[model samples]
Target: MLTVALPKGALLKDSIRLLQSVGLDFSAFLDSGNRQLQIQDPTQTAQGLLVRAQDVPVYVEYGQAQLGIVGFDVLQEKKPQVAQFADLGFGHCRMSVAVPSQSPYRSAMELPPNCRVASKFVHCAHDFFSKIDLPVEIIPLYGSVELGPITGMSEAIVDLVSTGRTLKENGLIELDCLYDSTARLIAHPLSYRLNQYNLEHWLNEISKNSQPLAAKAS
Candidate 1:
């Protein structure tokens, strides 16, 4: 059976909706009382694995899931060896550098070299700084990275910014945006190359039903 890995947070609704458009219903994951992490589609066409957005690529890369849906940011950070099929065009956001509102630094480049930068996305943060030739400590903060700057533990934070509400409420300002992120379809390279479980057809149907990769969701 073809197994799909589904992310568990904000992207869940749109992801399930997209899958439904392709005739695979995995909406059980949306139930208010649904405790099951693994569910088979009612039509028994495929199965869904509910997992953290960050782990979606892990499952697909290891072949635990033949196909998966995840955010582009996670893919950029993880760099998992999986075939990126298409951008599903939802879950729009950006990874940005933020600092306390009163901080002297006006941009990522303005921050002093060797300063501490905190983030849950350490890899993305590192890559961004490396390209700019800034030598800084990338502190890995899995929870509440804004606290790094708030508590004076770090000079800035690299994190996802949606509507900028959280940043505003915390008195943090965006210094620079590393990249915009959207949900994407992914498949195990070997499985995709071999068309295992007739995966190519399903992937094609999904792409056909989704908006063009360049079309952002409003």
Candidate 2:
């Protein structure tokens, strides 16, 4: 069976919808009482694995799943060896460098060397600063990065911003955006190259159904 790794948070609803459009229903993951992490489509043609967004690529890369739907940010952070099939395009956000509104630094480049930058996405944060030739300590904080700046633990934070509401509420402001993020369909490299489970056909169907939606989103 073709197994898919579906992210378990904000992107889950749209991911399920996209799969539904391609005639694979995984909406049982949405039911309040459905606690099962693994589920089969009505036809049993495929199965869906509910996992953390960060684990989507892991499952696909290891062949535990032949396909997955995850955010671009997680892919950027993890840099998993998976074939990026399509931009499913529902979860839209940006990876940004933010600081206290009153902070002297206005841009990522302006932060002093050795200064602290907190983030759950340490890899993304480190890469962004490195490409800019800025040397700083990337402190990994998996929860509420905004507090990094507010509490003086760090001068800035690297995190995802949707409407910027969380940043505003915390008296933080965006200085630079590393990149915009959206959900993307990924596949195991070998599975994709080998055409496992007739993956190519489903990929084509998904791409056809997905392109118009992605275009609309763009």
Instruction: Determine which window of 10 residues in candidate 1 has minimal summed lDDT.
Output: 209-218
Which whole-number lDDT from 0 to 100 does residue 12 have in model 2? 96
Q: What are the per-model C-alpha RMSD values against the true structure?
A: 1.3, 0.8
* Model 2 agreement with the true structure over 1-218: per-residue lDDT tens digits: 99999999999998899899999999999999998999999999999999999999999999999999999999999999999988887899999999999989888889999999999999999999999999999999989999998889999999999999999999999999999999998999899889999999988888788887888988
lDDT of each: 0.94, 0.94
Q: Estimate the lDDT of model 1.
A: 0.94
Error of 1 at 168 (Å): 0.4
- How far is 59's C-alpha from truth in model 2 (Å)? 0.8
Q: Which whole-number lDDT from 0 to 100 does residue 180 have in model 2?
A: 97
Off by over 4 Å in 1: 212-218
